[model samples]
Target: MTHNTDLPDVVPIFPLPGALLLPRARLPLHLFEPRYLAMLDDALKTPQRLIGMIQPNKVPGRSGSGLHTIGCVGRVTQFSETEGGRYMITLAGVSRFRLIEEVEGFTPYRRARVSWAGFERDQGPEEGDTAFDRGAFLQTLSQYFDSQDLQTDWDSLKEADDELLINSLSMLLGFEPEDKQALLEAPCLSTRRETLMTLIEFAMRGGDGEGMLQ
Candidate 1:
């Protein structure tokens, strides 16, 4: 038999600039700031160490402005102590959420009331087979990597599963902020793949093959 636990009433928050997380994916974070150290402590004390990962326009002290309405919630699945009381942690994406409202009267870190509606909807590629222009896609990726003079294990790349291939390529390509948002919000893996190709073509034509390398 299986049982379900009521969702936790508390949500922890973490904001990053220009970073995104897909469902079931993982993000590694280094927590050293005093505010975030407090967050880590709160999470460690709670049964659910859930944090909302958002992208800020600038680092906290620099600007603390421009945040996306959508973000992913993740749990600190792994944590370890580091020098100087810092923390190294890996957060596994649980779901995407929409910022409902910002709440005050809490800890130093920013807090928000969020909802995960439409998060688990039909957003991934169809189970089983995802059709794509494999030959053309590989050719484009190879040429792009080559033009950038970046070394990649072709064999490993070839062997990479579709999710890994798409997400990795998406990250490597330095797409504009809006473009990255579109890719993350794409309806399915195949659609995301298509967007990736479009970005690659744009890069190739603009002599921006190195953009992805950085």
Candidate 2:
């Protein structure tokens, strides 16, 4: 993990909604769009090979839209260019950063000046045995998964520690963008666990107008 002190003044980002990558988590991307393919190409040339995963407020004009401010910065740990003009890459998250401002650059993809000051703690591993309500979280998650008819490995789920289990479910579950953003912005693991539980219950009750839960 790169120290917040060592993070660059600016980093290129891919403003994709409904797509999220959290610190210490891994996100695999299919770079098929021309602009994003170009972004991937440029990222691989640098030693850091980093990209910020963030949600955009609205449609981007030439200048792009308002970003949600906080995002996870990850390094391109794997890359492969397909013969069909596509790129496959895996980003291993390093730290979260706040978008300070946009940088006017010549690159095809957008660039942002970011500040990692408050998110310095994201560099290390998640705390062990957090005060989060693990039992309730897993139980609700099991109910939600069963409702969705999604198979699960109960033994493997038990092996996941607090941070891994919480963040993994947060990312993998199909929650509304607002719900996802809430989980991302939660101040700590305990809060995030509680938020996840609430969101699941809401979905189960058909709060989103859909009979099924996300």
Q: Write model 1 residue lDDT over 14-81, tens digit each, in one string.
A: 77755667656677889999999998888888676778787654224533345666777777899998
Best-fitting candidate, scored by TM-score: 2
* Segments in model 2 whose C-alpha atoms lie over 4 Å from true places: 58-64, 209-214
User: For each candidate, what TM-score against the reference?
Assistant: 0.80, 0.90
Tens-digit per-residue lDDT, 136-207, candidate 2: 767888888887788878888888888888888888888766567777777777777788788888877767
Per-prediction CA RMSD (Å): 4.9, 3.5
**Per-candidate clashes, comma-separated:** 0, 0
Alpha carbon lDDT of each predicted model: 0.69, 0.79
Q: Once superposed on the true structure, which residue ranges of model 1 sit more than 4 Å away at CA?
A: 1-10, 57-65, 122-129, 207-214
